[model samples]
Target chain A: ELKVEQNPLFLSMQEGKNYTIYCNYSTTSDRLYWYRQDPGKSLESLFVLLSNGAVKQEGRLMASLDTKARLSTLHITAAVHDLSATYFCAVAYTGTASKLTFGTGTRLQVTL
Target chain B: DTAVSQTPKYLVTQMGNDKSIKCEQNLGHDTMYWYKQDSKKFLKIMFSYNNKELIINETVPNRFSPKSPDKAHLNLHINSLELGDSAVYFCASSPNQGTEAFFGQGTRLTVV
Candidate 1:
């Protein structure tokens, strides 16, 4: 069974602060994804890290993958109030499969 | 337009009743999946279909059946619904296996 774990399941940071959420998986995966979800809305894709050392950034968020270490990270730069949401790291099944094993999620609460 | 959409955003029903949630993606993806989010907010894969062929079937109960009529459509039908079945169900699709997936807004299933 592949297990995906996220550290600091709950995080509260003030606006303009920086923090990183870690995602560690138990097995090798072909790809990893970062997603964000509001309290009552659907998940929105943030980044897709497809290879080792792959890093992607969008606005105040950056995601990187270290496949060799079976880990991924989502870093927030200068967090803002709108960044308050649940962030999830999902690992894709190996080979040509679309199934995903998701982490426990990190609920971020950015305040002033 | 919604890339992936699931009908009946909210469903409330009595136990033992049968219900189905519909999902359709207009993104022309070849693979679709069904995921369940429990109260604790842990997301788990339930079923996956690639080009209308059953590809991944998680250890979900037999009462939950997933049907895919086409590459762009997948539906989950639950019979003899139990209280444990209450959760937020999401439908997702990807252009191919091991790729970024677009998710639906999710259907909140509530069993009374």
Candidate 2:
């Protein structure tokens, strides 16, 4: 069984600050995904890192995967107040069905 | 048009009631999944179906049943719902077994 853990479960930063949330998995999987969820809303897919060095960015959010290290990072660049939400990283294990194991979410609160 | 839609965005019922949530995806994906998000916001996979066949059931209680009439539709039915069953249920579909998934808006179930 693969377990996923994330650090800084709760984050509070200024509107202009930058931060990165780290996700560490127990297995050696190359497929990782980032998702965002707001209050009372379903998850929104942020990035999918398929390969070892895959890095994707959208707006102020960037995600990267390092299969060798069993780590994935979600970096928030110049965060804004609207970006306050919970972020989750899920690792996909390929089998008959790709089982996604989600990590402990990081709740971000961007303030002035 | 909504890529994925779930009916009854908000569901509030007393404990020991029975309810069902319907989900439909227009993306023509082959694999669909049911995920439960608790109040603490821990999202866990409950069941998965591929082409109207069951794929995964993560040790969930037997009271929760998933029916997939077709490839594009997956519905969740819960019998004898309990207080602990109060959570948000989301339906998601992917193009393939282990690929990018698009999620529905989610159905919030509240058991009082």
Candidate 3:
């Protein structure tokens, strides 16, 4: 079974601070995804890392994937109140369908 | 227009009742998935279908049944609902096994 784990399950950071959320998987998967979910809302796709060393950045959020190590990371360059949400990293193993195994989400709370 | 959409954004019902959640995607995707998010915020994949064929079924209870009538529609029917079944259910789809998925607004099921 493929397992995905994330660190700092809950993060509380002040605005303007920087933090990184780590995602580690138990199996080899070239496809990794990052998603953000606000309170009482559906998940929103953040980044899709398709290859080892692939990195994507949008605004203050950047995501990178390392397939060899079975790890991925979501880096927050500068935190803002708007960035407060639960972030999840999912690993996909290609079979008949790309089954996604999501990591334990990191709930981030950015305060003033 | 919403790429993916789910009916009954919120549902509240008594235990032992049966309920169904409907999902539809207009993105012309070939794969659809159902995920459950618990109160603790843990997300798990319950079922997946590709091209109207069942492809992935996780270790979910038999009471939870998923039906894909077509390539664009997937419905979940829960029989004998229990308190533990109370959670937010999200429906998502991707173009194929190698692309990023688009998620629908979740259906929050609350069992009393």
TM-score per candidate = 0.97, 0.97, 0.97
lDDT of 2: 0.91
Task: Compose the digit string of candidate 1's lDDT tens values, residues A1-112.
Answer: 7899998899999999999999999997859999999998999999988889999999999999998899999999999999999999999878655578899999999999
TM-score of chain B of each: 0.98, 0.98, 0.97
Q: State interface RMSD in Å for all models.
A: 1.2, 1.1, 1.5
**What is the Å distance of residue A107 in model 1 from its true position?**
0.2
lDDT of 1 at A75: 94
What ranges in model 2 sit over 4 Å off? none
Q: Using DockQ as the measure, which candidate wins?
A: 1
Can you list the residue pairs that collide in candidate 2?
none
RMSD of 1: 1.0
Which docking band does candidate 2 fall into?
A: medium
- Over the stretch B1-112, how does candidate 1's per-residue lDDT look in tens digits? 9899999999999999999999999999999999999998999989989999998889899999999988989999999999999999999999987688889999999999
lDDT of 3 by residue, A1-112 (tens): 7889999999999999999999999977899999999999988999999999999999999999989988898999879999999999988886555788889999999999
Instruction: Spell out the clash pairs found in candidate 3.
Output: none
lDDT of 2 by residue, A1-112 (tens): 8899998999999998999999999977889999898987878889989999899999999999999999999999999999999999999986666778899999999998
Pick the lDDT winner: 1
Positional deviation of residue B78's Cα in model 3 after best superposition, in angstroms:
1.1
